[model samples]
Target chain A: MNLYRAHVLICGGAGCLSSGCKAVLDKFNTELKAHNLQDEINVVETGCIGTCDLGPVMVVYPEGIFYQKVAPEDVTEIIEEHLIKGRYVTRLLYERPASGEQIPFYNEINFFRKQQRIALRNVGLINPEVIEEYIAQDGYLALGKVLSTYTPEQVIQVLKDSGLRGRGGAGFPTGLKWEFTKNAPGDQKYVICNADEGDPGAFMDRSVLEGDPHSVIEAMTIAGYAVGANQGYIYVRAEYPLAVQRLEDAIKKAHEFGMLGENIFGTGFSFDLEIRVGAGAFVCGEETALLASIEGKRGEPRPKPPFPASQGLWGKPTLINNVETFANIPVIINRGADWFKQIGTEKSKGTKVFALAGKVNNTGLVEVPMGTTLREVIFELGGGIPNHKRFKAAQTGGPSGGCLTEKDLDQPMDYESLVAAGSMMGSGGLIVMDEDNCMVDVARFFLEFTQDESCGKCTPCRVGTKRMLEILTKITQGKGEEKDLELLEELATSIKATALCGLGQSAPNPVLSTIRNFRDEYLAHIREKRCPAKVCRALLQYSISSELCKGCGLCARNCPENAISGEPKKPYTIDQEKCIKCGNCLDKCPFNAITLK
Target chain B: MAKANCPLPTSNLSEILDKYKQSPGSLLEILREAQAINGYLSREVLQLIAEELGIPESKVYGVATFYSLFKTTPTGQYIIRICESAPCHIRGAQDVLATIEKTLGIKPGETTPDGKFSLEFTSCLGLCGVAPAMMINDQVFGNLTGDRVREIINSF
Candidate 1:
């Protein structure tokens, strides 16, 4: 193989792709060819570099210089100055939001330096479309090791020792799940990779599939070997078209490489894999519901005493694991359980990938150890909340998650601790909130989601969520009564106990947790008829400050409801009765007169 | 590829139906592919899929309505899905949505008179890093402001 002096790794993950990384990629190639550096310098489109706020992000190899928001226009200066002339492009380097201090190296950047990538080891490093790149990164070696040497029981023992739990919400022991399926009485057992990631703020699974599809495939194939199963299926979300495509390509290529098809390593243990695309349903994230969807039915959850281990798809014993869970299997096989155990906390023995988004300055994917403090993840790694805003809260899990305030920042992020703090590690979506965000509105938004996505098969999840949403909605609308709070608490408690599945069981968490943390905000909305964050429109009343209003008639002309009226060079007053709260007058006013109280 | 009114050609639908006819538990995939050709799964198209798969029409329709991605009614050429999830909500998705609605002279679940655009609220497109995001067809646009929303709508 020919060696290249430089490697340009441009982020091609969903975040950067949406941010127009493709144009910059094309420009890099064009400039590289123009300068006759195409052969000498390789331009590789890698996965998410984890700083999504500075998207279209790139990292130059050998030097490790990290650049953000890279445009096609910036490619020339980079190629001409950095690649050819050996001088760094200072303007493109990542600058700290608070201090404006530039950090040039990728390893030195706070966002990535703090992360301990295990499942995500190959994500941003290898080209997912090519199998060679994955193989070079020790991809199929674990499968080769497991097939060549380790017995089925031995493989299961290694996984059990590794203490890797499922990353798909519930954090069940993966080894136990695999062992149960292996021990279950069935002639045709199946291993499933649940890629139906429905959590709203989380995209870690999608990133894993898109960036390193082979990792999931190789891991699933290893799982099939360990669990004594000959067939496997990956049920992925249809919304993730890129992930599905990459998985499809990876599976076909794995076949050609003799890593996936029948009689692997001449061991006579035949295994095959297929991909099932899910029609959009949030309930499908549940294992039972996901199994039903794969069987070409309406995705709905059933009670799980007769779990998938004994009775699963088509009355067969099936071992199902999440995409992130499967991605960890190969690593455990390659490096012994001891190496994996050294990284994380006692109970949660691995790094968790978080989709750090919302008000944070550095919004993207970050994988940190299990015991990392919320404060470290937010303030140090995430670059804190943007625009000098005080950190209000961080909504962990998803719609089912609770809000973590300043008090919870110092707490270690683990499965037990998060649940004790009124939250769960539900797929690792950490959405930060600041002063401008309303807790009541945030609760209301999640309720609207759970209510809409509820399968309606169960009365409690379907109906209970709707009622809870109604009360929350009433509170936001400034029509809430004092009795509404007691009613919301009672309903939330019952919904947690009586709901059919995980979706309904955790549906009321955001509301309950928010009320527990920010009851003052809720009380202000209900009793004072004011939104503390000025977020709820119904509670917000628009008024014009007489001192600031110049009376140019701009506010009057722009108001669709004709709410503002005044004469020239005089103070303008907004008619509250006529105002629809559309904020047209606020946007149109030249002077800073309009305010939403 | 007919507009909201006309019946779609069953020839392409039959090909999609026939390809997945033998695959067990492919009703959703078949319906999804059928919609790709017809734009929206018409009653006749649903009947065709049901008949081809030997499943009841009600079963096919049940599966179709169960998932949000399948559209029974005809949408405009472009389906603009604005994510209303909490992540996007805190990032000013409301304003971006309002701008789109005002620009198109329609609300969510409504299409333009010329069949150029249809607005809908999606839970999350997983583009939260660049919050206040929307997906038109498969392309995602993020970090959206009101002026950017207008510019995107006009471009479409």
Candidate 2:
């Protein structure tokens, strides 16, 4: 082994990869070699550090100095000044958005200060491709302890006592599910990791799989040992190519190190793993649909009474847990159940990872304790809404969740509390909205998504969601009536009651929750044919403000339809007949003359 | 001379099939690789895959058509996928989409006349923080603006 003076950890997560982190890494290599410090310094490409807005980020080890948005040109400075001279680069560090104070260390940043990293413990800290780094962090110790010391019953009991529930949305107890599969009459069984993360704004599972691939693999092997299974499958979406590559590499490395494959650790127990990449289907996130897709079928959900525990994945007893849920298992085994039980609320133990996006200052992945309030997440951790926009609403749970208004900001962000506030914590996609966002349009956007991705297997989900979307579409287009609102309510309630799976049953959540909270916005759209947020283009009538219009002919020249008729040095007029509501004239008007009524 | 004589390649097809021939869930994997080799999945290629995998042609075609990733029709040199989900939409994805459409003279789900780029709006690329994001082939572009869209397409 080689000892190094300092290690440079660059984030190679998907967000950073797109932001040109690869170029930065290459620059570091060249600069370090040029400085003749290549042998003394080590560079490691790690997974996401959760502060996605600050991409192409790097951290210098030993001092643990954090750097943000370091481009290729800045790598020379970082390598020469920080790496060689032993001085921190003040310009590159992440300054607090509000306070404007530069925080040098990763843990001191407000975004990471409140986070309790159970699943993401090794994400930014270790190189996922290197097994030795994982081993150094005590990876696979849980599996080693389980294989040598405890039986299947005792392992399941510890999980049960730890009160770990599924982070995949429904909050099912992980231990009870394992026990059911273990007790099921079967000589052959299987364990599966649900990495088919279909939520649009959510990337928790993708981050975990990309950053700490071995954590999930180690936990899956432990799950196999507990559930009396010898084979495991990780079903991941094909869109995440980087995640797939890391997982495949991790599995290969594990087998070479005697961590995976048959007769591991000389305990005479055998287990193996394989990867199944899913074709794009939102419904495949459902366990039944996922198993069906893996079996080379059309990826549709089957009715549950013969649950996955009883008859799953080829009609045999199988244990399935989300990627985040499985990532918690190894830690629970290493640290006692009592230790794991101490971190979170009474009902919801451990931390929940959320992909916070939209309008917020610090938009990224955050893992907070289950009972953390929405105010703390959005305001404190998230650095509040960007551009000083007043908070309008926060959309949680993707299409299956509702929007919470300002009043619900103080509500505890857990499974039960979120549900009580008219939104279920469906995979932790918390999208913040500002004052300029149209609530009705927000609801319509989610409805359109659910309606398009309905799978068409069940009647209520396929047809009923379509009906709700049609009503929402009409309202946004300024063609709505008062009776349409009542009709929408009726259809949403019926769809909720009659839909087949969780996808169908929660299809009306976004619509229902918007109506429950932002009913005034809906009424204004229907009654007055006005969009207060100026988002509904169809409802907007473009006109030139006579007071401010200079009639420079820019609007007329830019307009594809020749909507504006005007002369230079005089006020202009817009022809409603020719106006297309394309917002071209609005963007062209320099004096802020064009107004939409 | 021998390569020029053969219009289509069948060399990697056999190797890919041999690797995944035993697995029951190899149908999707085979279709993906076959599509990659040929750029798009043709009837002849599908037939060759079915014959190599020892499965019926109808079943192979069904699996290909079932997946959104598999392309039956020929695509352009570059596929530009813009995320139109709620997060991106709220962050002005429509403006970016309009700009791309105007710049390319092609709408979503249509290829340009030059066969250089095809524009399509997908659900979410999972890079919501840097909203109004797009992907050309496999490379994701985030925090996109109208000016950046034209520059990005010109580079491709």
Candidate 2 residue lDDT tens string, A138-184: 89999999999999999999999999999998999999999999999
Across residues A527-569, which tens digit of lDDT does each residue of candidate 1 receive?
9999999888887788888889887989888888887888998
TM agreement with the true structure for every prediction: 0.98, 0.97
DockQ by candidate, in order? 0.81, 0.65
Error of 1 at A304 (Å): 1.5
Tell me chain A's TM-score in each of the predictions.
0.99, 0.99
Off by over 4 Å in 1: B1-7
- Give the Å error, residue B35, model 1: 0.8
Worst 10 residues of 1 chain A by lDDT: A45-54
Residue pairs with backbone overlap in model 2: none
Residue A397 CA displacement from its true place in model 2, Å: 0.9
Q: Pick the candidate with the highest lDDT.
A: 1
